[model samples]
Structure formats: C-alpha cells, structure tokens
Target: MSPPDRKEAEVRRMLDGPHPLVPPGLGLRAAVRGRRLLLWRRRLGLAGWLLFLAAVAFTVWAVTQQPWIPPPSRTTPPLEGW
Candidate 1:
C-alpha cells in the first residue's frame, strides 16, 4: 500500500480500539494546583512593586540630605601678612 493508504489503515485500527483511561480526581488536582500558582504569581507581583517603591523613597531621601558632601569649616582663613 502507498503512504496515504497505510496511514488510513493505522487510523482505522486506532479508532476501532477501546478509549484510553484516565485516573480519577485528576481534574480536581489540576485546578487546585492552578489556583495556587496564580496566587503565588500575584504575591510576587505585589512584592516587586513594594521593592520598587522602597528604592524610590530611599533615592529621594539620599538626594535631599546629600551626606557625601563635606560640611564647611567654621573658622575663617588666617591673614596673608599678619
């Protein structure tokens, strides 16, 4: 037989066989796992936003205080020809 005929015969054989079996409670387990994953994803997104906000707040505080710049001296410079 040609390729097409062979394929058709294989398909007919498969169709004539009994249906495949599935384990009980598989759908319930899948749904529960899906829900848990969605909740975890939501929590991660919230955490990312919180970290971003904290970084922005810290940057603003640092810029305003500018602790890296040294304080000016209190005393005046000595006279050149005193």
Candidate 2:
C-alpha cells in the first residue's frame, strides 16, 4: 500500500482499540495551563511591541539630531590684521 494508505489504515486500527482512562482533573489542569499560556503570550507580545516602538523612536531622534556630525565652533577665529 502507498504511504498515505498505510498511515490511514494504522490510524483506523488504533481508533478501533479501547481508549485509555484519563485523570479526572486533566481537563481542569489543561484549562488552567491554557489560560496561563495565553496570558504569557500576551505579555510577551506587548513587550515586543514596546521594544519596537522604542527602537523606532530612537531611530527618529538619531535621524533628526544627526549625532555623528560635530557641533559648530563656539568661538570665532582670530581676526587677521585687526
């Protein structure tokens, strides 16, 4: 049989067997864990967005300020033949 057919037959055979017993609290535990995972994911997403905004703000400041260029001279040069 083809690989797909073999996989389907194997799945059917497994389904025909008796199911295993699950713990009574499994669903409750799973729900709690799922909620925690969602909260953690949301926190991480917010942190990522905050970081991205900070980077964008820094870039804008850098572009506008042009920190790489030196500032203008504070004093005038010596007057020639005063």
Candidate 3:
C-alpha cells in the first residue's frame, strides 16, 4: 500500500484499541519544558530586535551624510564670456 494508506490504517488500528496509561506527573514535566522553551524564545527575539535596530541606524547615517554629492555654490554668477 502507499505511505498515506499505511499511515491511515495504523491510525485506525490505534484508535480502535485501548490506550496505554500515562507514566506519572506527565503534566508537570510538560509545563516545565514549555516554560523553558518560552524563555529561550524571548531571549532570541530580543537579540534579533537589537540587530535590526543597529542595521536601521547604520543605513540612516549613511544616506544622510551623502559625501559623494557635491556641495552647493554660495553665489550663482557664472556667465558665458564668449
């Protein structure tokens, strides 16, 4: 049979049969794991924000400086002598 059909048959067999008992304190273990994962995710998010802000600041400074553009003339009085 195909992989999907095989998987469906296995699921059907499992649903028709009785389930095994949970070991003890499953909820407590799951809660502790979830809390640790949450804290890890928050720290990663803070670091990502700091990097993003630094890039934006660097871009702003580079564009505003515009060292390549020539400075404007103080007085425009260049007429053709020919």
Candidate 4:
C-alpha cells in the first residue's frame, strides 16, 4: 500500500478507533518525523544561527555598558564620622 494508507493503518491501530488525542493529518509517528526534520535542519546548519549571533551581540553590549552610578559617587566615602 501507499505511504499515506500505511500511516493511516498504523494510526488507526494506535488510537484503537480514534477519539481526540491525534491531530489532523498526524499519526502515531509524528514525533519521529519531527525529529527527522530537526536533524536535517541541524545538518544543513540552519538552526538557531540568528539567535546565536543575537545572543553574542547582547553579551558584548552588556559587558561594555556604563556603570549605573556617576563617576563622583565611585570614589565618594560614607559620612558616618562627619
């Protein structure tokens, strides 16, 4: 039989007549298919690339950001003994 028919049979067997747990056009092997897609994308170097660069840039900017307090406060001492 064709792939879709085979998948339908397997899905039917999995659900034991189908109630509501299965999504449309998805079978019991959806997780396997999803993992395959993720692997293919990773192999093609198409995963989280933009996110990686954005994270690196954010780190650098955060490291170089000026301190919250002003320069005068940096060396000022407490007035406890005054």
| Each model's Cα RMSD | 3.8, 3.8, 7.7, 13.7
What lDDT score is found at residue 22 in candidate 1?
A: 85
The local distance difference test score of each candidate is 0.94, 0.97, 0.93, 0.76
Local lDDT at 73 for model 3: 81
The digit string of per-residue lDDT tens for model 4 on 29-55 reads: 787899999999896675578778889
Question: Candidate 4: where are CA atoms >4 Å away?
Answer: 1-47, 66-82
Top candidate on lDDT is: 2
Q: For candidate 3, lDDT tens digit of each residue in 1-82?
A: 5467888899999999999999899999999999999999999999999999999998898799887788898998888896
Off by over 4 Å in 3: 1-16, 66-82
By lDDT, is 2 or 4 better?
2
TM-score of 4: 0.29
lDDT of 1 by residue, 1-82 (tens): 5466888899999999998888999999999999999999999999999999999999999999888999898999988996
Cα lDDT, model 4, residue 9? 87
- Greater lDDT among 1 and 2 belongs to 2
**TM-score for each predicted model, relative to the true structure:** 0.65, 0.73, 0.56, 0.29
In candidate 2, what are the lDDT values of residues 1-82, reduced to their tens digit? 5466888899999999999999999999999999999999999999999999999999999999999999999999999997
